[model samples]
Target: MSRYQQASHVFWRCQYHIVWTPKYRFRILKDNVGKEVWRCIQVYSAQLGCEVVELNVQIDHVHLVIKVPPKISISKLMGALKGKIALKLFSKFPHLRKNKMWGNRFWQRGYFVDSVGINEDIIRRYVRHQEKMERQEQAELALD
Candidate 1:
């Protein structure tokens, strides 16, 4: 049971199971590289206000369970996470670019995203509340 996030009229617990892989599914995420990947995920996720509930960096692919806010789009969230991790990973381990990758591309294009939990009604209610709060905030700001 994850803690629910509350803001004005909104209350949510948005969690997702995300999976992705390196270019060509290479078994390069080992030893230091694996450790670095985990670190990057935590650091980058924190910067984006997302909580990583669980993470596993296998040799070829990575699995992550993350909780994000309702206002953030899945595409934007994934893009930021993958982009920052790749940038940092490449910079820290330049040797990876020698032959494993090309043109600074580390992780492959596109990823898998699945909303966690089985309570669709709960998520729906939270989304509705979040929208209502946003509208109210905008109205209040407009009055000033």
Candidate 2:
């Protein structure tokens, strides 16, 4: 499981690996643009009460691993994030807004999100050692 966070009545761990590409897969994110996008995501996630565990901005797409609260729906979060980030980029980097082909849109409408739940190490240990644990218990029972 992911690192759980607790409130007075809520103890939860909900994380996701999200991937989104630019419109028509244009390789526009580079240098300042990429850095700015990364910063925007980080700052915005924090502002929205989410924790950005990892962010990778590629030329055409971005990969973000984030810890989000159970209360927020993924669709709503993405819609807000994509819209705000696009507006910020268009304003700060006017050249990006000038792209006629892209018009005013920056990101693709559809995005990919996978639940990053249940760590690999724990699964591996359980799969490899469950029989051993059962055997140890059986031995102890026989002694008693």
Query: Which candidate tops TM-score?
Result: 2
lDDT of 1 by residue, 1-144 (tens): 646888688999888878898989988899999999989899988888888777777778887878898888889988998888888888898888787445678888989887978864554444435535666898999999
TM-score of candidate 1 relative to the true fold: 0.77
lDDT (CA) per prediction? 0.81, 0.82
Kindly give the stretch of ten consecutive residues in candidate 2 with the minimal lDDT sum: 120-129
Models 1 onward score TM values of: 0.77, 0.79
Which runs of model 1 end up more than 4 angstroms from their true locations? 119-144
lDDT for 106 (candidate 2): 94
Q: What is the lDDT of candidate 2?
A: 0.82
Model 1 Cα displacement at 144 (Å)? 73
lDDT of 2 by residue, 1-144 (tens): 546897678998888778898999998899999999989998889888899876777777887778888888889789888999999999999988878987789999899988877663443344345546667998999999
Error of 1 at 105 (Å): 0.7
